[model samples]
Target: MSERGGPPQQPIIVRRVHRRGHGHHGGAWKVAYADFVTAMMAFFLVMWLIGVGTREQRAAISEYFRNPSLVPGNATLAPPGRMGPGGASDSAIKLGGAMDLPHGPGKDTRGAAAASVDGRTVEKEARRQEQARLQELMQQLRAAIQNSQALAPFKDQLLLDITPEGLRIQIVDKLNRPMFDLGSAQLKPYTADILRELAGFINRVPNRISISGHTDDAPYSSGNRYGNWELSADRANAARRALLDGGLQDAKIARVVGLAASVPFDKAHPGDPINRRISIIVMTRQAEAAALSQELADEDAAPPAATAGPAAASPAALPAASAAAAAAAPGVLVH
Candidate 1:
């Protein structure tokens, strides 16, 4: 095609496709920028975690991301002799932590552990609140003992403390002022008055009470059928009656027991007059439930059979370790 009359001189024309901006304002650049920001954020998050977390946490995190794989909780690309397609191993073949996430026996173990931890936390909080309430009750009783003119006279005998079971109020015997008549379960007039006074204060709480009577090492001469055990039991029952007469609810009495001389208040001096005492424990709800359970079991026509030999006999009959453990642990908690 000759345009200029000579051999083929083409017309010169320039066609320019103008770009608004040099790809800087395009969506692709925005996407790249977003990726950059995400990378920076992830980097900073990793750094923050490194600063805050423990060594174990860091190791676990590192292990979690060590090999980026499709399967979670499994890291192996291909286990030896168990290789699958694409020269890799399946989730079942991977040998690592979090056993069988997609499917297996221990898949729910972590969930169970988390649930257990939560349960423990809740239990701890409840226990703390209960302890605070019991402490407040103790303070109230102490203040009463301090302010009341009638109770101040026998303040030396009134011993109050907190046990895991509940708040224990022990009325000990002084050398000059014995709580009961000589060699008898009969309470003195003053002792009865004291118990009567305590009844109203204790009735303020809804908690049930456990009454336990203790004796000194002195042997009571009442024959084999009735000795210190019977005397202590009678004394505890007497105290219970006094409390009841003083306006305590009949249902408030959970248990009444006499320990004889088995658990002396003054272990250093077992024969001390203070060893002969009465312990009134205001039991917690949990403890009350346990007590009820035990009582129900005992009352059942066919109780669960314990080993015939050891638990039946005295702690003295057991091995040294067993005896020590028995002494340390709260057996039946209260009477």
Candidate 2:
């Protein structure tokens, strides 16, 4: 029972409907997931940096991002809290890690680095202060010498220099104004006065002192039969006594050496007027004493070969005599 058109008739409808992705909601979600992953990776990198970087390095980095000009060199940068030209974020500055801060007593790396810097600064300051004090002391000594009327005559004969050993004052002898009378160990009145003034300065400083006596190469004709070595020693001892009498503490004087003609001022010209002088050396550091001691030990430990020439000759002569006896005895043995 099929009617002409009704038997096979189908309904027809026209409409448009948008369907979601079968596998995914939308590509927008994919973009969000990618952003999230990138943020997590950046966070992990920041954590790693924070863990390994020193306090100073971290602060430098933070300060660099905050104000690139503040870095050692004037490097250009983008604004703070923003990505740089290469898409590098300045988020490290905002993180405020342990190294980002200025180190206090026990804050972070900042503290430790600051402590080291401060310690170095203090040491430098101490050295500068010490140098200034030494310069001031030298100036005072110069002024004292200049002001002393007694030292006026010896001013031209005096030579002063600053060495690693300390202050060295040399008193050269003048032909007419000798520091002492001929063949006498006593200091002249004027020389004594000069020493007194020098002694005052020496007593103020906390350094060891040495007084050395030198003599001209001229042979002793004083009729006392004393040579330059004895004369030089007497003179050194006399000077040491004068210094002690003039307010220098006995303990402060480290040594008194009579160099005689051994250490001349002018080796090429032994008769040079400057060769006959006394030297007062002040020791600034203990190393100077140690060096001097080593030098003395080396001198005392001279090789035996250098000193054995006479002894060796004597033994050689004995050997020759023994050979002559042996040759003379050969004929006697036959008899």
Candidate 3:
């Protein structure tokens, strides 16, 4: 109510109140935050510079940090004498923009190149050793043919080849003269003789033997259960038996498989008689070692057999089998 109702008194104003503390005391925290940001930026800048330096430059920088007072390259006087290490700038340090990363263990370029060279050298040496071994084996076979007269009668039928597996001795079939019966695994008399003859000579070497039987693409005539695959396997086994009869050690046999028309001798003529044949592979030491990796651990590879006599081999490699094979399979039978 206005005094004595003269006028409507205005409501007493109470809109203002005092604040407790003036705004944020001063900006001390801002100065501290600015300093922290600046320090971080400087740190990252130094890291970037170090990251972009060359190997030698980085080394020099690291050395400088280790001993900042020491100067390089006889840089004794810089300002007073006006002398420097062959440059207008008194600094001996080279700040070339070499962005080479620091090398750690196993990261050296020279070491890697040397390792590659060593690998190539090893491969070449292995190749040379394999060739020497094959040549020695060939010489042994030639001497056997000349001296023993075992293969003289059927020399024309023999075919020799060098394959990645090793030396392959292919005994192919002729038109009228077949190694096995027309459609059976039964060996002809001549076939058995040839296998036996080959066995005796092959036995002299320390190498193991592999026999594979192949057949023509023609299907078998009879037997619902038996087929060409079975026949081929049986034929290979039969050959193995003949080899055993010819005094080849039982342990000399490595593998016997049947490949019925899979790897045909005459690809153009799948049904050719020559396709029906037996292959005797004298597996190289490398191949033999690879086989051992799948089956069992083998002995360390011996150096190639000594090149002494045509039929040179360890007398200890006699065909007693049980003990002799164990002794001979590891080392080359050097006479």
As a whole number from 0 to 100, the lDDT of residue 66 in candidate 1 is 50
- Report how far off residue 305 is in candidate 3 (Å): 45
lDDT for each residue of candidate 2 in 16-135, tens digit (9 for 90 to 100): 998766756557888889999999999999999888876655665665455332212222244443333234443456332222323334333434555676576666666566456557
RMSD of 1: 9.5
Name model 2 segments beyond 4 Å from true: 1-131, 221-225, 295-335
Q: Which segments of candidate 1 are over 4 A away from where they belong?
A: 1-111, 289-335
Please tell me which predicted candidate would have the highest lDDT against the true structure: 1
Between prediction 1 and prediction 3, which has the larger TM-score? 1
Rank order by lDDT, top first?
Answer: 1, 3, 2
TM-score: model 2 vs. ground truth: 0.51
**Candidate 1 structure quality by residue, lDDT tens digits, 191-304:** 888899899988888888999787898987855557776778789989999998899999999888777777778889999999999999999888888877865664574334
lDDT of 3 by residue, 218-323 (tens): 9886646566767777888899999899899999888777766666778799899999999898887777776656434223333346645467433222212322
Q: Quick one: best TM-score, which candidate?
A: 1
Candidate 1 matches the true fold with a TM-score of 0.60
lDDT of 3 at 175: 85
Clashing pairs in 3: none
lDDT at 106, model 3: 38
